[model samples]
Target: MAAQRTIDVRAVGHVAERIYIHDSYVVTFGPDATSTNLWTLSNDGRRLDHLKILRTLEEPGGIAPIVDTERKLVAITGRSSGPPELHISDISSGDLVRTLMLYGSLDDVRMPYSSRLGHALVSTRVVDELPRVLVVDVAGNGWIAGVAYIPPDLRTSTDDRPDPQFGAEHITDDGDIICSYVAPPLPDGVDHFTLIRWNGTPNENTLPAVRADLSISLVDGDAVSVSCCLPFCDDALLVSACEAVQDAIDTAYSRWSVLRAIGLRALDTLWTAEPVWGVIRRLHHAVDAGVVLATGTQNAREDGGKNIPVSFIAAFDDKTGALRRLERVNHIAQGVSVRLCAATSDTVIVIFANGDMSMASLDDFLAHGLARDVDTHKVATTQLWKDDGKKVVHAALASTSVIVATQTNLVVASW
Candidate 1:
């Protein structure tokens, strides 16, 4: 194996919003942050610099910066305090010039994601109008969801044609809002997914806004995947999930004493949809070289608070539903364990509370080596994320000053 490279974090402050891949170093900025602070560094853990993301009113870190090579634009996937938002930067001048946002006021919230093609997609929870249905948009500002108001005088038929055939006021300049993509909302509560798209002109060779087709018809309940993200964008949209279903504890008893994981998978209806299940919690970063997933599973579980079991670690292939690797963590603090996916490789790094970040190749886990543990403790502050009944978790890569922001001081990262 190659010698372990060192990534000097030059700086770590308030909170991070997004990390933008720049020509020199990866530029990180904050969304709800106060000042426009940007952290810059090279991709190979070499050169680094820090600059002002925008002028003033730095929105902190609520967006991710993507390099639009074709458009020569440094596009930012940003969010705001009130409704969700998406901002694009004028790479020519390093300024946030364009914008996008969710239109309707759904009971819950919506999250923005992107395809490999640079086209962004967002999903939100819908209430009043429909239950168990998600509102969606692909073209962003070029779309809208509304009903054309028809006057009584225009009705000539006896029953006054109920809804207009072309009633759906859609595909404006905002974006294309597509419905009926996923199977349907689960019955009880088990995370399910769907796919939708916009044809630019509804009929043209523009581009296929293909979405991940997640179906939940078989599972008659509500279930969601939160805080987990796909490693990268392959032909198929593959995602990884980590649910520490139990809390950590320290006990003293010796009957040939050995602690184990006690995970409790819950099944509820009401609370399921309220929190929006199966949402991606975070995206540490994408790795293009690997197509596998690594996991650290807990044996013991939780009922109220989230759980973490320092017991086991495993790996799997996203293309084929096959277990690639698995290992048991020598119980450190009883029921507490976690695996952090590396940003460049398919390496699932382990972090313990004792503050040691170690890495083990998932490739070796498939051959023979046990889930080599990396004892690492995240240096971050715990903060409460206020989500609007939407089964959504913000993957905002909070940073100091790489791009301009609308607000600042987003929730601090716990891990």
Candidate 2:
């Protein structure tokens, strides 16, 4: 294998709300959410060339542009002269393909890579009416395939409590809508949040039936925290579940957390792994790479409440959970959190909160005996870039390169 090469590209004045990357190109959303610029990598993979300016929406609505790299399309929200609308355009030609007027102000939009062409789930809110989620088909002439209003039970609150709010909502490729709703605390004393999945496509004037209520459906009946749940591969959800326990030694309450992969459609546990670190936090589900990468942290209890941060890069076989390994990441300072992680098939790139970057090999494993005997082994890694608090805005991993972007610069490291 060739030695890895790191290159720094000056991206002054190229700030963006978000960045999306493919193996061949990179797309940056305008910081003001008005336009998007598509950039193609140079032949030597060291520089980025301006491909074309993709003007998505006609009017600014402060809606962030969603780039679907798999479909080579960009979706944006606007309200020029009529109702709030969504615009779909091609990334290559920058040609407007379809425009659909929405029911009200667009609150959020989610597009699944495997969804039908020009299809997405959009949430909108009206002045006096409750929020509604609409299934939009932007092909040819725009049309609304279905609509689902917020349930009356979830729209109101008790006299003493505040109104329940919706958290993260996802629309799967099969038209399954998964929403997280958090309600006021009940007498049970546990967090009253539920992960609801509506299976099947919603038809005109009819909402799909709810298939699973994940809050009370698990074997242990522990509420799955939506903030720690990650949607994976359009069909699976990576969940980090924590259950309080009474420590026998200290006679105090402690928490035990485990990571599991749950199939959204079948409503089954695909696989589970217990990390030595008790807390599972940041997660990356790289389906294309066939591995799930996550970071686990635990504080030291013996050191007078001082934190001994134990951060590990765990790799798991996505399908069968055949290969499970916990490797400690070297050189990360104490109390510095991992802000972003991007993984390809063979490489994993991590950026710390302090603007330091490191790359590790996912394919290279420690010897079987050594890994089994030791509680944690370090993955061989290379320090690609470091800064003293410049702050990484976003990062994306492609087949041949990893791109890290800060407010003032873009760095490309390729092998």
CA lDDT, every prediction? 0.33, 0.57
lDDT of 1: 0.33
Q: Estimate each model's TM-score.
A: 0.50, 0.67
**Which ten-residue region of model 2 has the weakest summed lDDT?**
366-375
Instruction: Give the per-residue lDDT of model 2 (tens digit) for 66-168.
Output: 5666677766667777788877888779887777778666653333322354456666766655456676775436587666655555555345553344433
> Model 1 over residues 31-132: C-alpha lDDT tens digits?
445444444444443334454455334353333444554454554434356654545555446676656555333222223323323444333332322212
Error of 2 at 375 (Å): 18
